[model samples]
Target chain A: MLDINKVKQRIESLKKLPAIGSKSVKEVLEENGFSRRDFLKWSGALAVSLGLPATFAPVVADAAEVSNRLPVVWLHLAECTGCSESLIRTDAPTIDDLIFNYISLEYHDTIMAAAGWQAEENFEEALKKFKGRYVLCVEGGVPTKDGGDFLTIGPDAETGLSKLKRTAKDAAAIIAVGTCSSFGGIQAAYPNPTGAKGIHKVLNKQVINVPGCPPSAKNIVGTIVYVILFGQLPAVDNFNRPKFAYGMRIHDLCERRGHFDAGEFVEEFGSEEAMNGFCLYKKGCKGPYTFNNCSRERFNQHTSWPVQAGHGCIGCSEPDFWDSMAPYEEPLANHKFESISADATADKVGITILTLAGVAVAAHAAISAIKPPKE
Target chain B: MKITKKIITKIEGEATLKLYKKDSLIEFAEIEFWQYRGMEEYLKNRNYMDACVINPRICGICGHSHLIATSKAIENALNIKITKKAKILREITLGLEIIQNHIKWFYITLYPSVKEINYFKALEFSREIAKIIALIAGQFPHNSYAVPGGVTCDLTNLEIIKVKNFLSKMFDKYQEIIDINGKSEDLEILFEDIPKETGKGINKFLVLGDNLYFKSNGNAEFIKEEDSISLNKNVLYKGSFYEVGPLARNLENYLIKKVYEKYQDSIYTRIFARLYEVNLIFQYLLKRIDEIDINEKNYIKPTKKSGKGVGIVEAPRGSLIHQIEIEDEKIKSYNIIVPTQFNLSNGTKESPSPAQASLIGEYEKQSDLIFKCFDICAVCVSH
Candidate 1:
């Protein structure tokens, strides 16, 4: 009971914007040799990925096509370029369309054609031209130690920290793209030699965080599209992640939840229970604590996520995951401390408590036997 | 007269290339990786197992390679033995990583720079390969699926079917690329258009790690000695620059032995080697997937203890090595020599580094193409 003609009409009007009307969403898909059916499928999948109903696919398609694509300046700092790579490697819209049709990726160090001074010049021009309007997407963390000397950006000897601050001053909003940019990923782990910090800490602002080791491409694109459509940042959780993407714990919607509740757990990898697709909680899955829509919006075009692949979630989307999520093979919230000499203090304490309880029970039984005639 | 210092773009991470030119002929080219996060230095005193998760974040493209390397290093340190099924799964994941990486390099990075081949089709193929990776390794870019003793994931029949289907489709697409570029089934023709002497470096090839597709050529002793002695801030082997990655892997393969015999080390050979490996690795992955038995144990519980060990993996780019010294179950000191450190090192007094030497000629117009031939990953270099 779908009105294909009405949907096409809605798409037609949506593609009428002067800035983005040159290539209709349909035309863009066709240019990429994708049919209208493929576009609809993508829109529906994107809607689901964004935690919206299938009926909202038309609205998403319309919002994506009609809105004037924002000129995005993506910055890379003291971390890997994985976020950008993930964005480009998405299968739904194709990376080419996402770059060319959706957003004006004015300056990206990894993928841009301009090199050296020219690239720097392009960034300056874009910043000036779209001042107080453009959206700044930062992928990596900022190294704040030693006056930000750890990570430098341009030929002018400008550090990444300094550059980010200057660029963010005029930006309408910022999108912290990955865990590194959002929560000082691995670089900010123990010892943190270079003193890397996320953008929120450096900027002291409520930048929308898409916090995953490398967040799903759909979430990244969906958040940006929401910004363009609503002319404001989407609703975010306490962690500054969009509610649509990071609203619920991965455990809430995990496919293995039934098994978890049924008390069928995978104690060991490649065990019979593991082969039968039991819950991975016992093997240290952090899905119950981690907040990300990975279970529903699986990576690589909804193929499969970590739990489905028989691995427990490492809680990459959470803040301070490196420190808080250590000893990945053990369950969270379970406490057992062991010293470097392999002395188990927690085990000793447990044994003492159990022995004392047993002795108390025996003493009470003997006392009761002695007083048996009183009742 | 003046050093043409320029910031190189279109690579994974950012770097500054300083061409010390004397007249038209370049005397030397020094590649300075200014972006440093000190990952190794910061890893000190942290839990040794955390390295498996942290090391992968060094470079997004080759994160799985790092994860496997870290896991292997920990396994070596603990003397833990993984089951055959776990080893096969690890190799499958690694194979998928390499295939996806090479496809992306060919289509996304290299083709656009060289103005050769269809980028979109190549992107689609790589995306499929990434799906296979995610199917097995949980996700691409950063998945800590490989723990110390074994991988976290165990294969089910459903996963096997999914991976097999994607692999077949990928094989077909790869053949299409060969057909379109080479006019034959053989992929060597795809490199026929590549100019000789382009991006040629020292003939010395260094390959480490053993997998189903690739095996070290009985050079373990030499590799260990070189790994221990020559690895510093400026990574070198036997006091000389050496090349690693696809070209090195291809030099050892029999299928592409003729190509290696013809062109020892050049841009043409490097590109051909990468393309050849895509086909070679795809076939190997399919066979490995079929060989996997889900009934076997996937991991052995690792005990907290003190030890020192070195782990090496043939990453998509080259050999990724991780050395860990554990004291009381915590990492006392850790050293990581990424493949880029081997290929993209700053030159020592003995000779110009491989990356620097490749850019010595007057090919400024084809500088990006020449650089892409090396598959430069600045993130790994800086890490």
Candidate 2:
């Protein structure tokens, strides 16, 4: 038989730790209408999403509650507000509680009550108050064409790039929230009239990229919590994305990897192979090349992800995905030459190479037959 | 006089609104979209099919609609006939996107500006709807599930059961919002107190494509294609400044027609129409799921590649149309006329833009509410 009273006492003591002070995790959970069991389950899921073991759930929860909640100044620039949308709809803590209790979201134009000059004032005040302390979260790409006239945040003459520079000057560190802010998403696609570039290009500073079309909400929160607990950024890859979140290729973690190795592939939509859950590699899946934890940390509260839904990975999180990993329904060629025709497929080039070799061998045989051997 | 210039916030995308006042009364209002990404220019010389993936990034809220429109345009260009199962799945996915968009607009954008409601509940419901989308369409905000020929996903028994369970719960939740004593007349009563002319725009309405509710009549000649640039010359059919979205869909709805008769094109009717459409589409989706036959073919192979085509979808905001010209299997030119371009027009000869027209009155203090009443998506407008 379990000692219920003793268990409650132990939980109470755990809640009183410096990391989890008077406002216990249980209290916050209850306020969000979540039971203690639910909180535990959510924490465990968060731990998994953060690439940590299930046993580390309690530690993660403690770390989340221990540090002083940082003030987040979220700036929206010349891209869609999808990252903010994804962040607000996270299931665990509920966006209401996340903004109200977890972190001080000082300025977000889309959700903040303040508007016009007042909103600008709030941004300035937060910049001054938490100078060199608060995290600067930029969601969209910054346009640098025509002196950055494409995107302006406020009534002032400061362009999006100028504002980002000004804010980063007083920030502890910068977090580029989406692919737009990280690697210049669709806005930076070919013929980029606005000259939209990621934050790393404009501001000569290290900006941790949480790169997805709109990154999974759990990843966003996990990155922020890691910053809060460790008092520094996590280990990043060549792209500046945290290795924990984007360390491995999506194909390595895909459920369809067995089929890929077995050489079974879906040649067409709704085919027998597709129904049998074969590999989508032949169908323009960028999974083998793209690095993201989408397969492990599924979207929409772990319901499903792209490949699971029968589509190929578009390689959205990868840098220059729009230019490099395009023609989303076709396989990516191994080598590309700028001088070659854009429509020259890998099969065509391979056939041409094989034909040239065959002809050369035939010519050598003919020469040997026509003339007497030197010996 | 105290005149507020460039006051904008709480919207999906950014915009600048300048209000000119005379003796405390608003004299005129001007709206400008300061951001432009030039998506059309980017589409030139690219593979035609890539539009399905790239077009969705225009507006995060209505991305799936753009995806569907792009897919449809490609299908039109290639003359590919989609299977019944594919059509139904696409419709269901689009329905989910629109439902989520309307719910977000109501609770997140409109409700905060008007009245305080249980926003958490609304977000929860939207998340549930988004889960259905992610199940079939991969993920929300930028899912390119619907390709040129058909959808990339195929339904299984497990998905069917999951969808059925979700629909039942969604129906119950929706009933709680609109149903009163089993006779759902709550919307009518909720808008009875609102004045008829409040936020009323032009009387003209246009629907570009066929949906569960309305059938496409004919193509509206609103845009003209030039040598290199396509211009929206603001062509008027029977009149100018036509309304789209829920209001246009409800113009034909029998139940909403009763409400529209009372309040012509006011904000109350628009909100009621959206709420009504949400319930109607939810019921429609439940039936649509049952109509799906998993064994049937889902896509038809495309044969033709070089042709000009137009595709239109009823987006959450309004009618979203995509036109593409394919030459030698590459996109020669691409032009898109989103719902925002129509509703948030630069004013026509007959009337002002719906957004600007709504701001014309002594209600300068309520400009934000009036602006949001149009559910303006600046990303779509400037894309």
Candidate 3:
């Protein structure tokens, strides 16, 4: 039987905590013990049921709570606050609250109560206090031309380029939080004007990059926690992202790999194949080249990710997805059969394949028509 | 002074924020959009049908929606009248994309701050949802399903049955979820519970209602139906134009509009509007699927003719307009007005932009209010 009064009592008691208001207390109670203990088991069971990473449960939980929480000094470059909005939405056990309370987030632009010169002062103070100790988290990319004139700092007086470098110098480790911060993002695509560059390029340091239009909140949190626990950053790949997070390509984990192998694809957005969850390769998905934990971390607390929601990977996690991943009608990497040389245009390959398929079908039909009667 | 910020990138391009302080309270806030793709420029000199594949890749989360919208715009420019079969097919795909987008937005963007699950389950849920999405769209983030003329694939009975089954199962789960967590109806009670969104101060509706008298095929509400309001012009609230997006879409709908009108334009309205879309689209998906005609071809292969065309579709975000001017088989001029342009642009002092209206006049603290109002996408706006 479900305990009612006990839950109410727990709510009443938990509400006594300093920050645990009655609203929060009620939420916890409403979820019952599942929010406390069963959430992981439930997720683990579901992951196993869904043939995903089952062991990631405790790993994620334990990563959420580790010792020596690193101080993170977040630097904003040229961009919107969507990345921050996405971040605050991560649902790890009190992770948002924990991020606020437990971890030493010395300076952040979006949610920080301080603004203007006072905000800059706060950043300076934090940098001074946590020099050679804090983790530097960079959102957005650095504009290189005109002395980074594309954006300005707290006041428009000085450029943001100097401000970013000044702060980055004192950091123990650096994390590029978005695709822009990771590999120049859309800003650096095609006709790059501002001459944008990722964090590692501007700083010339081995910064861990978490690339996405806006990366998963859980991925961000897990990475921070991993850093806190292990002291040095987690093992990163060539892109300087934690191997644990960006180790696998999206294709490896894509649910529609079966469809790709079966030669089934969604030719249009509203087709029946799309409703049936077919491969989006033919429709211009970047799953084959993109690398990230989106297939695992997912946006909005695993409710759904991009592909699951009926869109393909635009290779946001890759370098210059906007420029390199363009002409969405074609794939970025190898085309199967190596049939058409990599240099061949999508239209040419498509036409050639169509012709071959037509000829093959015609020959098969003629042979069938001419075949002797079977017993 | 104490300062706090969540450094996040990868959601919708790159976003970093810095807050300034006067004493203990925040005084000024700066939001930076570092990445610019120049999509308008990218579209230049490309085939008009390029949007069918390219627009969807703009933002992984809403790519399919963009693709459909772009395709619709092309259909309009080309004067290609779609049959009911094509309309239903379009609706089904768009509806599914909308459903998944909203659900994922809730799970990934909104739910994290709800003080519900810890970080562990959040990751787990994200993975599961991504897989489920992949089962349908082939990949996550940016799926390119919208093709010019019509959808790329035809629906088989088996595929339709599978989709119907999945949708039914998902809806049942969501119903239980609302019942447990609290339904939008509970939120609707904000008329009495939350005073800010309702009462006399409620804003007027600015929508794309077709009030025309004649029967036009591509019209949203009723082709050429009277009483349909023209939403082409900017929305004037008080003395200025208010932008549209998921929130604006909700205002146009009859049901959630009531709840949101009650909330006026608070964070509740912004959040609820998107969630309600998720719920509404689920129903729309079923209806669209039922109306689909399997026998008729969904697409007509377009010849790469030398001409210009514009495409527009109602993305999950809002009205996405793509204009393409082609010359001698190459794109000459390409212009796109994304939903974010309306939501995030800086407006004049009088009426202010929709995001600006939400911010300039109201709210004691500006950062939170700005985030609520702007609903910004640095990528979409900048690029």
Against the unseen true structure, what C-alpha lDDT does each candidate score?
0.73, 0.73, 0.54
Off by over 4 Å in 1: A1-26, A44-56, A91-104, A335-375, B116-118, B179-194, B218-232, B253-255, B261-263, B348-350
In the range B62-129, model 2's lDDT, one tens digit per residue, is 88888999988888887888988889888888988888888778777776665544466667778888
Candidates 1 onward: DockQ, in order: 0.47, 0.48, 0.11
- DockQ, candidate no. 3: 0.11
Better of 2 and 3 by DockQ: 2
Candidate 3: residue B175 lDDT (0-100):
62
- Over the stretch B18-122, how does candidate 3's per-residue lDDT look in tens digits? 444546454333344444445565565454655555565465556656666677666655556565666665565566555555554544343332223233333
DockQ measured for candidate 1: 0.47
What is the per-residue lDDT of model 3 for residues A195-268, given as tens digits with 9 covering 90 to 100? 77786887866788888766766567656655543445667766677776677778777887778767778776
How does candidate 1 fare on TM-score? Answer: 0.86
Cα displacement (Å) at residue A373, model 1: 46
- Per-residue alpha-carbon lDDT of model 1 for A1-375, expressed as tens digits? 334455455456535534523555455567778766666666776677666657778776666655444567888888788887787677345633443324644787866656567889999998998788778899988989999888887777789988999999988789999999998988887557788888999896569999898898877888877665556687887779999899877877899988876778898876679778898877778776688888877888777787887788888888877666655656644424442321312443343333223223422231222222211
Clashing pairs in 2: A19-A66, A284-A330
Weakest lDDT window of 10 consecutive positions for candidate 1 chain B: B223-232
TM-score of chain A of each: 0.80, 0.79, 0.72
Clashes of each: 0, 2, 73
Q: How do the residues B1-383 of candidate 1 rate in per-residue lDDT, one tens digit apiece?
A: 66777777767877677777666655677776677777886577667776876788878988888898898888888888998888988888898888888877776666655554445565666677787888888778788888888876766687778878878777877776553232333334444565665777777778887775676643433432232111125666666667888888667666456666776577777777787787788778778778778677877877759888888889999888888889877888888887777777766424767776777765565566666788888888778
Backbone clash total for model 1 is: 0
